[model samples]
Target: MENWFSLLQKNVLNQQSWTTREQLRLAIVYWIEARYHRRRRQRRLGKLTPIEFETIMKDPACLAA
Candidate 1:
């Protein structure tokens, strides 16, 4: 959790100047959901992103699906 926050701070927060509280909240959520969660591969998921792992588990017929 510390690493995740550190990455968020360095990559997202440090790179921008948010004007409002809502904007900052949305930016954090976007970084976590759209970028980090979808891009970071996990060893527990066989070196796949959470999205990839879910797709594989949902449809065993084709990995490309």
Candidate 2:
């Protein structure tokens, strides 16, 4: 959680100034969806990024989840 907050501070909060709560909310949502989750390895998926995990799941030879 510390790491996440640190990154958020550096990448989002520090990079720009927000004039409204709505803008801040949108920025956070966009960051989490576009950058964070796309690249972060998830433990439930055996540490694969969601993109990689989805690709493997689509393969016919891949084991059932």
Candidate 3:
């Protein structure tokens, strides 16, 4: 969780290194998709894509209460 947030923050908040916004966007998207999303499926997410599993778990109706 900590690592996930760090990756997002790094990509979103820091864009000065790239000369163009398109370059930065592409780089960030690639990193998120390839590094965090893919690795999460392989290890922590039971092979489900991050967005699919998150959509289910994020719903208020799915709460454990």
> Mind giving the per-residue lDDT tens digits that candidate 2 earns over 2-65?
9999999987899889999999999999999999999999999999999999898788655554
Give TM-scores for every candidate, taking all chains together and pairing residue i with residue i: 0.67, 0.85, 0.44
Predictions in order: lDDT: 0.89, 0.92, 0.71
Regions of candidate 2 where Cα sits further than 4 Å from its true position: 61-65
> Quick one: best TM-score, which candidate?
2
Off by over 4 Å in 3: 1-3, 9-16, 41-65
Q: Which residue ranges in model 1 land beyond 4 Å of their true spot?
A: 42-47, 54-65
- Per-residue alpha-carbon lDDT of model 3 for 1-65, expressed as tens digits? 89777877776656457778898788888887777665466546667878767777788666855
Error of 3 at 62 (Å): 34
Q: What is the lDDT of residue 48 in candidate 3?
A: 80
Q: Candidate 1: give the clashing pairs.
A: none
Model 3 whole-model lDDT (C-alpha atoms): 0.71
What's the true lDDT of residue 36 in model 2?
Answer: 92
lDDT (10s digit) by residue, model 1, range 1-65 = 89988999998899979999999999999888899989899999999999988887888766556
